[model samples]
Target chain A: MANNLNTRKAKQKTLTVLKFVFLFIYLVVVMFPFLWMLTTSFKPSSEINGPVDYIPNNPTMENYINMLVKGNFGKYMLNSLISSTFAAAVATFCGILAGYVISRFNFRMKTPVYLLFMITQMIPSFIMLAPLYQMLSKAGMTNSLGTLAILYANMTIPFSVVTMSGFYAGVSNSIEEAAWIDGCGYVRALFSVIVPLLLPGIAATAIFAFMNSWNELFMAVMFVDMDKFKTITVGLNSLILKYNIKWGEMAAGTVLALVPTMFLFGFAQKYMIEGLTAGSVKG
Target chain B: MKSNKRLGQRRNIFIFCMLLPAILLPLIFTYYPLIKGGVMAFQNYTLMDIKNVSWCGFDNFANILSNEAGVDFGQIAKNTVIWVVVSLALQFTLGFALSLMLKKKFKGAGLYQGLIFFPYAVSGFLIGIMWRWMFNGSNGVINDLLMNLGLIETNVGWLAQKETALLSCMIANVWYGIPFFTIMITAALRGVAPELYEAADMDGASKIQQFFNVTVPSIKSVLLMTVLMRVIWIFNFPDLIYSMTSGGPANSSQIITSYMMTLVYSMDYGKASAVGLMVIAFLAIFTLVYMGATKYTSED
Candidate 1:
């Protein structure tokens, strides 16, 4: 009996070690491309097409300098920042109001309204590409960053409403009811008491909206034709479309483009994960 | 009672005001365009001749379907099927495996999870750019790595060759998508009760047996929902393909959505709209059929 127990324990230890090894390998696979991009971004133009160096022989900041200066990437970043921020704000505000109504009110159109949002979320954004292009162009709204921001807000609203509705459902109605007893109107209670309580949830939803707008390539590529109004994705994509692709500058541009979303993920990873998994886990 | 009635009227107004923007934006942006696109699908809506826009019913659809417009819709349909099925299979299997390993806490598991899940935050376009370079015909990391590993003696033109182009994109997609499943399934796995495993153990069930009988059954709903959401998402995603290949080398890597993108790029709005309508219709039908099938199965 003692011998058998020892063998089983040894087998368990081996299995555990194997699992760790497997996990470690996957982690490397997951990270290798990003690491490669980083290292490539640091390498000089000459070293890029040469033997692949896991670590650059002599890392330099020239790529970054070139991307920011010669590549017009700063303009792209600014456009992205302004548009995404606007999109996030508008989306969050509308999402909160709609979510609050859906969660709290006993309206006649509640289910239908909620279903409208849900079904729209399932519909692909590209399906509207042609008509939107026509409408915006007819209105002379193409190439306008502000217009792009509004379109993005429209793009993210369905998701924002759905997610915010989930968050609102989690908060108790009693807090608002108490406020109502204190003579607070529904809107007043929502903005004052409930909004403060759901700040983290609001942040999560806004971050998601911001990232969606920031990362949107199709709309930006279609709508924004002018160089000055281009977002980061469009900027990077144009570089790829150019003949004789510049590897170093492209890598640098990609790295610069990723900073905001990656930083947001690091800062608010918890809320983002919670925002994503909360709905499916419960439902 | 009169005061209460007045208050109720005020509350209803407030609610309507609150919901107006959310409802109105979609109505203006999504619904209006949906209707316009539906109309444009049957019209000669080319950007080249916007003034001559007149109804041309079924011509765009017929041309695309019968290979009249050089689109090879049959190949595109096949490519889309291959793309969705292959990418979904690999992403789900690999992601599920990683989640299973990461579900139970181990030393440094959190950091590993964070690092592995980092790609989920990276945009699809960026992932495409990274992979496009990595899979470059010459001077690519994939080629270098393969040579080093003794897997291939010569460099392969991953994105240039018709055979490997779609496959290369699929690899990048798999890489980008694995993190989503990991994040989702890990959460679902954690929600599974420990007592179920214990009961299975007491019944002398093997580890694999317990996994299949207990853990899988416990997370079945989450799994189904996640898979459904992912299928729609993957089908909608054309960003990576557009960035990486642009359906290049005689349209070898062209899926239905990417082909629509090419039409959009060429300013063939009528054809693009037709394809868009087709996509929406297909997805609607697919969603209904999938939900029906899953609901039927689950009833047992």
Candidate 2:
């Protein structure tokens, strides 16, 4: 009996050590790219092509300065900010209304409408690529930031609606009903009673929508031709196409582009997880 | 009774008004483009000759299938299949393992979760560029590390080589995809009741047996749906390939969607539309089969 207990303890220790080893390896894998990018961004152009060093021997801010001053990265950042914000705002606004109605009301054709929204989530955005471009071009709306915002909002709305509805489904209807009995209309109750409760969900959906627009490359590259109106992703692609491989500047640009989403993700990590898992868990 | 009826009608109108933007935006942007794309697939359309476009009736599809005009559609289709399948397998396995590891509570677990999930927030295009630099032939971190460890004697041109180009892109894609599975599976795993595992333990089941019998069955639907969604998304994804290799090294890494993008770039709208339609059709069929298989199995 003592022998068996000793063997069990030994086996448990081995498993624990194995788990740590695996976790350490995963940590390395997840972190290596970002660490490399961070290091490369600070390296001088001369040292960039030299033997790869984990840490830059002589770090410099020249790349960031050059990107800001001469590369028009600032303008691109502004464009990205404008479009992403607009898209997220509009998508979330529309999502809240649609989500509320779907979750609260029992109407005819509700199942069909909900299914349509779900189906939209499955359809690849590429299928819409050619015709969307053609339609926008025909209307002479291509290359405009406002049009890009609308397009991004369209791409983000389905998921936003689904997420918003899931959040709404979580909140009990009793409070809203009480507000209704107290002589508040539906819109007033939504704003006064329910909207505050849904703040975290709204923030999560907004961050997701913003990230979608900010990270979008295919449509941005395809639709926008003008340099001034290009988003960060498009600008980075153009930089690659135009320049002879400038690794330092490119790395710096990538780091800068990653800032907003990373910052948002850091603060809203819980909400982001909740939002992304809503479909899988609740469905 | 008349007043109540009037109020019901007004409420319905209010609901409709509230949903106007959500309903109308998709109709104008999504369904409209989808229908137009189907129509454009059969028409001879070009951005340059839009005014004089006419019906072509499957010629574009025929041309692509036949490998006319040096497009090598067959090769592209094969590459796409390999890309999606290989990347999906790796990402799913790694992600599942990570999720399992993370399911156990430990010190700094939240920090690790944040770090692991950070990559999903990064743009695929930026990830492509970062990986492209890392895989550079002469002075890349990957080569530097490999050489230091004496694993490789020479710096291999990972992205530049024809054989390794697609694989390199897949590596980047897998990196980007891992967090998605990790986030999803972790969430699903968290939802699994601990009572199930305790019940299995009382039955003298080992950890492996419990995982297969209890954990797997519980997360089966989430796993199936996530995998299906990923397969379709990865199949349609062209951003990483486009940004990293641009379908280069003699189009060895070229996938169908990237080929479609090239067609679009060259202003061959009809061909692009045809390719788009083919992608939609393939995904539609695949989704149907997948849903059917899952439904059939769940009935057991």
Encode model 1's per-residue lDDT on B1-300: one tens digit a residue. Answer: 999999889878988999999999889988999888889889988889988999988999999999999878999999899889999999999999988888889877766776788888878888999999999888899999999999999989999999989999999999999999999999999998889888998999999999899988888888888788888888878879988998877888888888888888888988988898888889889888988988823222
Pairs that collide in candidate 2 are none
lDDT of each: 0.88, 0.88
Report, to 2 decimal places, the DockQ of model 2. 0.65
- Residue B5 lDDT (model 2): 100
Backbone clashes for every candidate come to 0, 0
lDDT of 1 at A221: 90
Query: Candidate 2 lDDT, tens digit per residue, A61-141?
Result: 999998888999999999999999999999999999998999889889788888777667666676677888878998999
Q: By DockQ, who's the top model here?
A: 1
> Which lDDT tens digits does candidate 2 get at residues B52-127?
9999899989988998858777789899999999999999999999899889789999988988899888777888
